[model samples]
Target chain A: MITKHLSEVTTKFNPFSKQAKTCRIFLATLPANARQTMKINSKVLPRDTDAKSELKIKFKDGREMQFDPDKHSIKDVAEEVDRHSRVLNRQAELAGS
Target chain B: MSPRLGICRDCLRKIRSPSSSTKRYLAAAAAATATTPAAPPSFEAQPPPIARFPRTQPPSHKPPEFRKSQLHRQYTSLLRSTPLLLLFQHSNLKSQEWVSIRRELSIALSKVDETYPQTPPLADSTKLQIIQAGIFESALRIAEYYKPPPPPSPGDSLATPSSSPESTNATPDPSNPIFTHALSRHAHDAVYKFKNAHPLTPLLSGPLAVLTFPTVSPPHLKAALSILAPDKQAGFPAPTRRASPGYYDGAVQAGVAKMMLLGARVEGRVLDQGGVQWVGGLEGMEGLRAQLVALLGAAGANLVGILEGAGRSVWLTMEGRRGLLEEEEKKE
Candidate 1:
C-alpha cells in the first residue's frame, strides 16, 4: 500500500482542514492510478487513459461497497464521494481520540 | 204698615176707580227689583279657577327595594361568615408576590377550565370570562407595579457587604477565599439541581451539552459538568482546549439564536471559577440551546461563527483552537 501524506489530499479539497481525516480515507479508496493523479494543487490533474473507468471498493472496516459507472450506473463522482464519506467520518472519529 | 194704612186711607178718600192700596203694593215691588240687578254682573263675568292643593311627592331611594336590601344583607353576611375573601385577600403583597399569585391564578383558572370542559350557559360563561379576564389583568397590573430590585453590581456589593448577608455571601472576596469557596460549592449544587431537574434530556444527550459547556469559562464548565454523573461525563471526550470565556459566549449566542429560530427562549447561567456566574431567569433555555447546537452541527458550519453572530460572547479560545489544531497538523 502506497501511503501518502493525508494533508496532501486534504489540502487539495479541504482548505479548512476540518475534514482532513475523512478526505484521507476517500483518497485511499480510489484506484492507485486514479489516486496518483489526485494532487493538492488548485489545477485539475490530467485524466488517465489506462485506468479502469470504475472499480468496486472494499473499505478497511469490512463494509460492503461498490462503485461502477456502467453496471452500477453511478453517474456523479461527487455523489460517490459522498456515499463513501461515512468511512472517512468513522476514521476521523477514531483518529480524533 | 203705616204707609200702607196711609195709602189705604188715601185710597178710601179717592175711592173713585182703583184703590190706593193697590198702587202702593206695585211701587214697593218695583223698588225691590231695582235694588237687586238682573243676575249680578260679577257672577256672569268670570268662571271658577281650578283648585290645586300643594303638590307633594314621596322621596325615591334608588339603590334597592326593601326586600332586595334585605337579601343583599343576608348574602353579604353569608359571604362574610366564610373565610373566602380573607383567604384570597393578599392585600399586602410585596413586589415579587404577584409573580407567585399570577402563576397560581393561571394554574387555578386552567384547572377550572380543564375540569369543567362543558361550560355553563352563555351568561355564566361570559361572567366567568369576565372574572378571569379581570383576574389576569389585575394580576398583570400587580406584577407590573412590583418591579424586582435591580441586580446589585459588583462594586455595589463590594461597598455594602456588611449590610446584606446574602449579597455578602454571594459576592466573591479575594481576601476571604473561604467565602469564594463556599459560593463555588453552592453554585455546583445549583447546577446539579438544575441539570437533574432539566426537562430536555433527549435533546441534551449529545451536541447540546458539548456546545453549552465550551461557551462558558473553564471553572463554570467544570462546575456544570460536575453536576452530570461521572459515567456520563466519561462517555464524551474531554474538550481538547481549556475553557475560554469567549468561546463559551460565542457558543451560547449561537445556541440562543438557533433557539429563537425554533421559537424558544434561551436560559442558562454563565458561571465562573469563582462560582455562580450570571443566572438568567428565562425558562426552557436549556432545550432551546440544545436545539440550536443540533441544528448547527447538522448544517456543518463553523459553530463559532454562528455563535458570534448571535450576539453571545464567543471567547478567543475558539479562534485559538482552530489555529492550534491547524498548526499541530501542519507540523505533523
Candidate 2:
C-alpha cells in the first residue's frame, strides 16, 4: 500500500463480521511507522451491529477516497490507493530540483 | 600343593572342578537310567501384555520433537486455562517498545493490586504473548470441540487381561482410540471437521498477541486497558507524565499507537472491543455481588410489605363489620 502519500487513514468495522477482514488486513498492511507519518483512526464496532466496514483515506494532495470493504477486497482498495499515489509521486518528481 | 602361575595346585584343581549340583544330577540320572528328561519349557507361552510406550508420553500424529507440536500443546493448555483473554493485533512493535509497555503495565496492575487488597494479587499471573495464528486456531478447535474421555483410574490397567480387547492390545499405536492427548491423531481427526466454524476464527488470522488473565478480574483488566488502548471517554485514561513518565516514553507510546484491541473472549464467549471496554469498566465481582444482594433484599422487603398490607386490610374490614353489628344490636 502507498502509505507515504496518505495524510490520514480512518476505518470502522465489526471484528466478528466476515466482510471486516479486509479492513483489518488493510490496517495491518500499513507500515510499522505509519503512525509517525500519517494520522490513523480506527474504531471497532460492537458485534451485534451489521454495519458495513468502511475505509477512508486522505491523500497528501487533499483527494479523499472512500471504500466499503464489503464491496471491495483489500487488493482493490490498495490498487485504488496506489493509483492516486502514483500521480502524487510524479508531481513530487516534477517539482523537485 | 605345588605353586603354579599365581595359584597352588590344590587351588587350581578346586577352581577347575564342576559344582556339586552337576555331580548329584549325574548320579541321579545314572541311578534312574529309564527316567525320561523333563520336557523343555513350551515356546508357545504368551508373555504378559506390556505397553510399548511410556504411560505419560503418548504417540502424537505430528512429530512430538517439532516446535509446532509443542506450541500446539502449549496453546491448547493456554486456551483451557485462561477464562478471560484479550486479543490484540500488533503491527511490528520493537523489542524495546514491548519491554517498556510490559514494565508500565506491571506498574499499573500492581497499583490495582494495592487498591484491592481483599482479593489475591493477580498482577504476576497475567501475561502478553505472541502466538502462531494457525497453530493457535487448531488448538482452539481442539479445546472447543474435542472432549476426551476421562483417564482410567490407577487400579485399572490398559493391559489387564480381563479388560476390553482394544485396551489389551500391546502395541503403542497413534490411531488407538484411547490416546486423546491434544497432539494425538484421534484429537486431530476429531477436531478437523470444525474448520472455520468457530466464532473466533476470523480474528485468528494476521499477527496476533493475546493478553490472558487468570481470572475475570475487572481491576486488572481496567489497568491493562488504561495502558494499552486508553480512552478518556471510556474511563480508561492514559497515565499522565507526572504519574507515569515511563508510559510517556517514545517506545511505549509508539507501540501503543500501533496496537489495536480487536476483541475478547470472556468465559468462552466472544466479545468485540465495545464489550471488552464494558468488561474493563466493571467494578469487580464483589461489587456485582453487592448489587445482586441489594436487589434481592429489596424484593424481600417488598414481599413482606405486600403480605402485611393484605392481612391488615382484611382485619380492618372484619372489625368495621363487627362494630356495625354491635351498634345495630344496641339500637334493637
Candidate 3:
C-alpha cells in the first residue's frame, strides 16, 4: 500500500544508506471504490473508540472521570449513608431474592 | 385654659350612675351599724363586691358529678359503715344472694371510682379491679390453705410444670400493668389522707389486726415490685407476663412475699400461730422482722439496700424506720 501511494518504483532499496531521510511525496491515488470504503472505515473506528471511553467512568463525586477504570464503579457519598443503604438492602433481601 | 375646671362627660356619668353600687354599700354599712351598735361602721369600708366574690379554686381536678361526687365525699364513712371485707365475707350472706350484693357493691365501687379518676391508662380500671379482685380471691384462697412445700427430694429440680396438679391450673400472668396500676390510682392521695388522720402510726404498725386487712393483694405486690425489683427483672414484670403453675411464677411469689413483708402479714400470721423467739413480751416480733427483712431481700436489691441503710444508722428512730414506707419516703 505504501509503495502504491508513494509511487516508489525502486527494484531494491538501500539496507545501510547513510543519506539523511527526506519526506516522501504521494504521486498515486486509490481507486474510487477503495477510497469510498476507506472513508467508511475511518468513521466506524472513531465511534467504537468513543463507546469504549464512555463505558470507562468513575462516579465518586456524583459523576467523574475515573483514572483507574478497574478500581471503582459505585456513586458513593458517605460511609454512614452507605452502611444504611446496605442495611436496607439486607432488609429487602429478607422480603425477596 | 385655667386647667379645664369642668369634669368630662364620662366622669360626670360615672359619678352620677354609681348609685346601684352606692346603695349596696349604704345598705351593708347601715346593717352593720344597726345590728352591732358597738362602734359606728366606717364609711370608708371596702365595697361588698370584695366580700361577695369568693376565691376561685383551680379546676385542675375534675369536679365530682352530683351523686357520684356525693358518694365519693362519703366514701370513707361508707367504708366505715360496712367495711370492704365485711361486704365479701359476711357469714350471713347467702350463696344465691351474691347477685344482689355484687350489684350493690358494683354500684358503690363505681361511685367511689368517680373520686379515683384515671385517664389514658392501659386498661378499663374498673374491669381491672374486678379482675384483680378475682385474682385476690384466688391468692387469698391459696394463703388460706397454703402448706409450705414438703421438704425437697432429689428429683425436685427435675420436676416440670406438668409434674404437679398446681401447674395444671396455669392462670395468665397477673403481672399485667393494668392490674397493678388499678391498685394505686389514688395512692398519693391516700398517703395524705392517712397522714392527716393518724400521723405515722399506720405506716409503722404492721400489727396483726392491720395485717389481716384484705388490701394486700397482687396489685399491691405489683406496686412493691416496681419499687423493689432489679432492672434485670426490669421495673415490674413485663405487662404481657403469663403465669405458670396455676396462679403465679417464682418472680410473682417473690413479689407477693415482699408485699407480705411490708404488711407483716407473714409475721402476724406467725404471731397468731406461735413461732420463733419472743422478746419484750411481743411474741417473736423481732425474729419475724429480721426474717421478713431477709425475705424481702430475696425479691430485689432495693429492699436489701434499704435494710442495709437502716442497719448502718444504729440510731434509726422508730418513727424513721417505717418498714415499706421508709423506701417509699426515700423515693420521694
For every candidate in turn, the CA RMSD to the true structure comes to: 40.4, 13.9, 39.9
In angstroms, what RMSD does candidate 1 have relative to the true structure? Answer: 40.4
Expressed as tens digits, the lDDT of each residue in A1-97 for candidate 3 is 2111111111111101111000000001222222222221110011112222111121222222222212222222123234544655566689796
Highest lDDT model number: 2
Ranking by TM-score: 2, 3, 1
Q: For candidate 2, write residues B54-101 as lDDT tens digits.
A: 655666789899999999999999999999999998887889888988
| Residue pairs in collision within model 2 | none
Give model 2's DockQ, 2 decimals. Answer: 0.48
Lowest summed-lDDT stretch of 10 residues in model 3 chain A? A18-27
lDDT of 1 by residue, B164-271 (tens): 433233333433333212112322232333332321121111111111211222222222222211112233222223432322333332222121000011222212
Which of candidates 1 and 3 reaches a greater TM-score? Answer: 3
Please identify model 1 stretches exceeding 4 Å from their true place. Answer: A1-97, B1-183, B199-332
Q: How does candidate 2 score on lDDT? A: 0.86
* TM (chain A) per model: 0.30, 0.95, 0.21
**Top candidate, metric TM-score:** 2
**Residue B327 lDDT, candidate 1, scale 0-100:** 100
- Residue A70 local lDDT, model 3: 22
